[model samples]
Target: MYKHALAAAAAAAFIHLPSTAAEVVTQWNFNSLPADGATGTGTTAAAIGSGTASLVGGATASFASGDASGGSSDPASGDDSGWNLTTFAAQGTGSGTRGAQFAVSTAGFENLVISFDLRHSNTSARHELLQISLDGISFSDFALFDADAGGDRWYTGRTVDLSAVAGASDNASFAFRVVSAFAPTTGQYAATGVGSSYGTSGTWRMDMVTLSGTAIAPVPEPGAMALLLAGLGVIGTVVRRRA
Candidate 1:
């Protein structure tokens, strides 16, 4: 009787095991602002979870008053406002000029995903690189975005999976480091105008950057499952003997 009772309890516990649900670890649409009617260039965006996102590199990052005339469609929210990272010739050239970082705490997620909307007035072939860091200092390249080469203003959506980079950590950080310059002197790229130097020269823009992941559920280890089965077998033998 005791053996059968123990086996039943074991099975019941296994059946009642809770399943883990995935969640949005962090998302930054760059829509929040200070009520004081003041916004800073490097201000951090309010995110969904405990993590925070902030502009790292660039002369200054701010919200666009309106969408670029020839650029990507304005965010569906129609705020006409989105995070803007502007590159100026006055600053160093290339990817070092613009960068943003999104850091999150409490990891152990599967299918880590990231998405962003971007627009640019600069000539095509300008490069945007995405990097991920486990330590928040050393970063490895995760993805890259190249301008359209057409030199027209446009916005486009991009998605990336970072499950490999995210690993099984409980805490991880992702950074978008954009290095840009005047579009190279290529066939159509040359007409875009002088690279970011004189007047409102150098500029790259982005918006609606989001990070998300699904929670990873723990599974019974092989040894544990085997032991449980063995216990059930013993329970069956004991019940048959009693019968």
Candidate 2:
């Protein structure tokens, strides 16, 4: 009976739901743009996976390619290459700040996961923020971390669970923004804001942005399920023989 129970659970793990592809919802390789540094003023739209990837930024922000220290994690220059951020403005100016924004529609998705790779060319500690929005206009804070600490191979990776923010909306328009710290007060660091020193010369790069989720509960492949069932059967037979 005990062996039988284990076999049942194992088989259950392989039970598949109907029409589950587990396809990628959205992805951005950024290979379409030129390798040289170019500031993005308008929206750069591309069809990715099952949705459209819209890359946009303000007047101060643009996408360029300069950081070479990312090594293998950094995407190579190709036909469909990766997009890098080149923030070349001071923060806290309100009007003359620089950041990168990506907007997309995540409809009919559940248990979503959002991830990306980032690298920076900062000489000192500068903070950058990752924000999310349900509507494209207003953004709420999500994560704040050091964009570049000037270490070896400073390329960093982040993965966020988007289950709560995504909810169950068919036309849920989601947006993500990476912004440097704004102008500082009497007692503040230049973490989020790109300094004037940076304004003249500083850069950030990003690549391999992806969003994925399952519409239905995940199950093992048919062949895998069959194998699991067979293994469980073998275990049960062995247990009975021992008893």
Write model 2 residue lDDT over 92-141, tens digit each, in one string.
34322346676767666676676777665542226556777777778777
What does candidate 1's lDDT look like per residue over 1-243, in tens digits?
Answer: 776676688677544464456567765555444332222232345445656665554445666632455544434333445566553433224433345666665456666777776665543235556777666666666676665443435456677777675342456544444344333343212223235322234445566566667776667799878886886677678778777
Provide the overall lDDT of each model, using Cα atoms, as 2-decimal numbers: 0.54, 0.55
Task: Assess the local accuracy of residue 198 in candidate 1 as a C-alpha lDDT between 0 and 100.
Answer: 27
Backbone clash pairs for candidate 2 read 30-81, 31-80, 31-81, 39-62, 40-62, 92-183, 127-191, 180-192, 181-192, 181-193
User: Stretches of candidate 1 above 4 Å error?
Assistant: 1-13, 16-22, 33-43, 65-80, 89-97, 123-125, 149-152, 166-169, 173-201, 219-243
Model 2: CA > 4 A from native: 1-23, 33-47, 50-67, 72-80, 87-91, 95-97, 123-125, 151-154, 166-170, 182-197, 216-243
The prediction achieving the highest TM-score against the true structure is 1
How many clashes does the backbone of model 1 have? 14
